[model samples]
Target: MTFEEQPIDYSNYLPDAPQARSVAAEMVATRQSEQVKAALFSAKQFPRDQQASFNRIMQACQRKKLAEEAAYEFPKGGSKVTGPSIRLAEVLAQNWGNMEYGVVELDQVNGVSKMEAYAWDIETNTRRSMIFNVTHERKAKGRINKLDDPRDIYELTANMGARRVRACILGVIPGDIVDAALDRCRQTLKDGYTEPLTDRLRKALLKFQEKYGVSKEMIEEYVGCGQDAFTENDFLKIAGVWRSLSDNMAKREDYFNITKVHVPSNAEEEFLKLQEVEKKEDVVHDISTE
Candidate 1:
């Protein structure tokens, strides 16, 4: 047949010709299966040593920064509730060995996203998984606002997923180890404040004011003590509150009872300026002015 008379084979273009979707799915399943098999074989070959893992976790918790961020304290029902933070949980899982942990977004529909947080003990074949739904909205100041931006939705989902992932890891890990890590973190925080107390207090006050719009007066009201009366224990509690606030583990209202922040008057501003000058003069050496 001449080239002009060649037949057009429409089979390739037919609706069901290649089954592309099924083929792709099969490939994905096969790859996932291979990964699982490899993970299991490797875990079997090299198992985790419990004592070594414990030491590693405790050592990791000894770092001042990690220990500082290790736990958050929040008030509930007229009592304080404290627990290991997500950062600490993640450290534990990493050192625990032969573990798989992650959060995955399975689907999003109708302003709600479905996600799964999972942790697996590869050597022991123990697994914990939690599936939950996150609504793409946030309640703030008695207002319910819907999130429409992609970035906002992603951040909301990730934040929610992180808490769930933390819980899953905690579920699989031993309780005693987590408790020990918390204790170590507490000691680290207690001893980590090597700077001058005045300097630490200044920085903390500035931070709380700048970050949360909380004034020194508000803090005094909350703690029932003025700045001069503040002790090392008070500073530690403030640090815990800061960590809790930074991680979104608790709200300002939960810790402070301030409904309206008072604006300083002109006289108060002048007093603060005088206080600052005196504070600076206290550190400055007396040099004779000729």
Candidate 2:
């Protein structure tokens, strides 16, 4: 018996060929499975209600596969980079998968911790904890292994009110330490805030007082008079004057004497104002000139 040739219903058999082909191409690009692509294409052939369920499954599977691939490639680990600028928290988090690395936990006060890690403030020689605070944590998070930009360090320290302390303690006192201090004090006063007395300044004051038998009251009086207002030039001038007296003291084993000296209550204020006056007209004369 001769069989009649049956014309294929290509439309029913193919079933949204364009959409199926497009979705299959996307699946292949996204590293999805052929089985998943076929199932998704088949779902388009079903009733709308059943189609939604199949679509959801296809999407979930695709997502799951993508996630697996990402985890496989990237993995869960910290950056391998190292340097002064790297955020201690991120480095710790990446390597340890959490804040706790080695035996140290993140201290809210100090910051992150790692064994044998080193960090130095680029502006000064001061070494800080390898751990970082929340703010620093954010700021230095993605920095590569390199010395942090000096400006970045300065801004960070200034914002934290730690610059003066760092400068003093590290003996990284800039040539313009006095001027910098004055500027800081001015900003503090302008903001109606109190500036922190750095340990270095305190130590310097104590040493000076001990050497000269100067009392706290005298120091307070000088400070109250705004001796801190002296500009860097004024400080240099004062240092020259002091050095002359010190040289004389070294030469003669006797107490240096100055009769009719106009000792201002506020040395910093007098110093700044006098330096300006001297610069303008050389009107105010120092006892050293005599």
Q: What are the models' TM-scores? A: 0.79, 0.16
State the number of backbone clashes in model 2: 8
Model 1 ranges with Cα > 4 A deviation: 1-18, 139-143, 209-221, 224-231, 259-290
Task: Write model 1 residue lDDT over 23-141, tens digit each, in one string.
Answer: 88899999999999999999999999999999999899889999888887899999899788889999999999999999999999999999999999999998999999999999889
| Clash pairs, model 1 backbone | none
Where is model 2 more than 4 Å wrong at Cα? Answer: 1-201, 216-224, 227-230, 249-290
- For residues 1-290, what per-residue lDDT tens digits would candidate 2 score against the true structure? 89999988777677587898999889776774654455455544532343443343233323322212111011013221111111212221222211111222233234322222232322222343433332333323466343245555444444343322222222321224223333333333334314343433455446544555444344434333344544333332223223333533121112222222333346766788988977766434544466
Candidate 2: C-alpha lDDT: 0.35
Q: Please give the range of 10 consecutive residues that has the lowest summed lDDT in model 2.
A: 67-76
User: Scored by Cα lDDT, where does model 1 land?
Assistant: 0.89
| Candidate 2 residue pairs in clash (backbone atoms < 3 Å) | 77-94, 78-94, 78-95, 112-131, 225-266, 226-269, 227-268, 227-269
In order of listing, the candidates' clash counts read 0, 8
